[model samples]
Target chain A: MHGKRVGQWNGERTYLLCVHCHNPHSPRFKPIKPLPPPQRPSEMKR
Target chain B: MSQDPPCTGACSGETAPDPSRRTVVQFLAAGAAVASTGCSLESFFRKSFRELSPAQVRRYIAELEGRYGRKYGKTVTVGTAGPMEGVKFGYGLDLSRCVGCRRCVYACAEENNQSRKNPQIHWIRVLEMDKARGVDVNHSDIYYDAAEVPRPGHFYMPVQCQQCDDPPCVKTCPVGATWKEKDGIVAIDYDWCIGCRCCMAACPTEPGTSTGPSRTSPPPK
Candidate 1:
């Protein structure tokens, strides 16, 4: 905050960069099937 | 391609457009190959060296260690133990102080040993945001060198990976190529990178970018 403005993603033991996640490591990450967003309580029928 | 002047807007003389499907396929494949080669920078991230077999991971690591030693004139200790998983770096920005001169970008390029041929790759990108909307990055150019201040209400913001505690990119990685280091740096093993462009989609930045190519080196003494 005082000098540098960069931040990284925390993965407990390993650090991640912008490309790390978006670029991926291997088959561990698969194209996920889109699921509907969680239903909002306010939008639910009263 | 180099001979061709950067094509400008509409009305540049066009050739008989042989934009065939084969051409498109070739372009895509070539792009993929280039992406893989560039990703070699992520030596530690990938399980193999340039897509070598798993049996070769150790040999590849040994070679990399040797290179690091020669390149920096020091031994780089990489042990047989796999890197402990799950570490992350936290970062933030106070846009008010950022002058938008892009010093940080150049610094990152140098620190990371990016390709000298292309100076755009690296860990940071600075932006000169408009006075109206301070966060807009798509249109801002840190390359601008006008002799002025605030750009009539301009502000500077130097940015890199935010290293979110819960990173979208981390959750999205397929092979676990990206990892958080104990020091909180989210590093990529360029070799592990697949050029799938998923990380680009997952990044939180206004317009996500993946840098490659190091800055130009100064003349020898």
Candidate 2:
């Protein structure tokens, strides 16, 4: 399923296989710095 | 008779109120309201993706491309590609092979054109699980910061949209904004979405869907 075409109905777009997004060597997602939580309305300066 | 009592300001004496003037003022007020909300009148009234005709779809796409190009200072193409016939997409992953590196998470984000800042959105989540506890989700940790992956006695599991055969998210959507395509991909109509987040709660694989905050400021010129 890696290199197969999705057919004419979809303008022959190639199906994105697993390897398209993932590296064979390390399939898991990398750790990321989490975004800060949204500030409360009460915390805003007047 | 005595110059109509000196023509009080509250009363229009010998002059009919102009309907055209009233209409213009009303239109100005409506235009201001729409502008202050930061949504164009056309976009506010645009039909859902499924409801749009081919001509309407093309017109909308062109409008979107223009809007996005101006915002990002680059030409942007928004494709409205439909599902292919006889195609049903499925995904499989080998738990033994996954090392929890999280490359897929960022890749998915970049591919989907999700927001990069203010509120970073990730569709995929990798959870670090202890081998001793097996597949217990309660014992898993998504915030694992190991110096290297495969954390000795731990394993990693990545979760994403299952694209379920019978999606509860679609069923729970009050506005019918989300649906499963013929090719098994679950799609959302952003313009039609009410931001109720019913789909988020209906998802069996918790947090499979997330909502982004509305843009509160104009894009930088």
Candidate 3:
């Protein structure tokens, strides 16, 4: 892979992976839970 | 409280005969012991940034670096650099230009040393919104993890801290631990922050907003 390479196919569109883009071993993003809402200061006791 | 000198072991000299004074001293000693076990005793009662002398601030930062370094098993430097004189910091994203690749998301997390384990913290979160709906963020999908992005008629919007002119987060902090700087950046004093997360809730942007795992089932073809 000199500078650009065709990565795995995904549906209809094709994506180009630049030499600087991602690690070949683990390219997918990890899902994160949204930060939880804050409770009232009084609720902290519970 | 300001008038009283910080309690020391030998501070009970003349007050030794008073029963109430003895009780108060005993209570303070117990509180100190608990705080010392939590973190450095000095840090627990550290003064606000405005109250600290320059030397005190430097020593405080050094102590933080040492403690965090030991915890993470690597040396880390905590900087107290202030913002530029007149420059204000703001973020702008061009929906037309973004491809929803999520490179920015990962880069921010790694750079900030956010936990990659449970309850990860990602400062930037990109949402895939329907172009037909214009800029309706309430309907935007943040958990969209298609194998490829720039999907069909959807537009991308990257959301982070907006640092509003009248930031609700700053107002919501019970203690004055969080504040907006002159340059329009909202900052939290971690040392003083009770971790109440009122600011997190007050922010217009959703918390824990980050690129998430791919859907288990494939999208309908």
Q: What C-alpha lDDT values do all the predictions have?
A: 0.56, 0.70, 0.66
Clashing pairs in 2: A28-B102, A29-B101, A29-B102, A29-B103, A30-B101, A30-B102, A30-B103
Ranking by DockQ: 2, 3, 1
The chain B TM-scores of all candidates, as shown, are 0.51, 0.63, 0.62
TM-score preference between candidates 2 and 3, better one: 2
For residues B24-73, what per-residue lDDT tens digits would candidate 1 score against the true structure?
65557656765777754344233333454555666777788999999999
lDDT of 1 by residue, A14-40 (tens): 434434445435443332222122222
TM-score between candidate 3 and the true structure: 0.53
lDDT of 3 at B114: 58
Report the C-alpha lDDT of model 2 over A1-46, residue by residue, as the tens digit.
5633475643756676567766856855554443222233344332
- On residues B93-122, what C-alpha lDDT tens digit does candidate 3 reach at each position? 556557677777777766666544444456
Q: Write the per-residue lDDT of candidate 2 for residues B1-221, one digit (tens) a residue.
A: 01112233544664734556555665687688778989887874572123656766788888899999999999899999876677898767778767788887777766766554444456787878889999988888776766667677988898888888899999999999899988888888887788898999989777644665523323434
DockQ of each: 0.02, 0.10, 0.04
Task: Count the clashes in each prediction.
Answer: 47, 7, 5
In candidate 2 the C-alpha lDDT for residue B4 amounts to 17
What lDDT does candidate 1 reach at residue A9?
33
TM-score of candidate 1's A chain against the true A chain: 0.28
Candidate 2, position B121, lDDT: 58
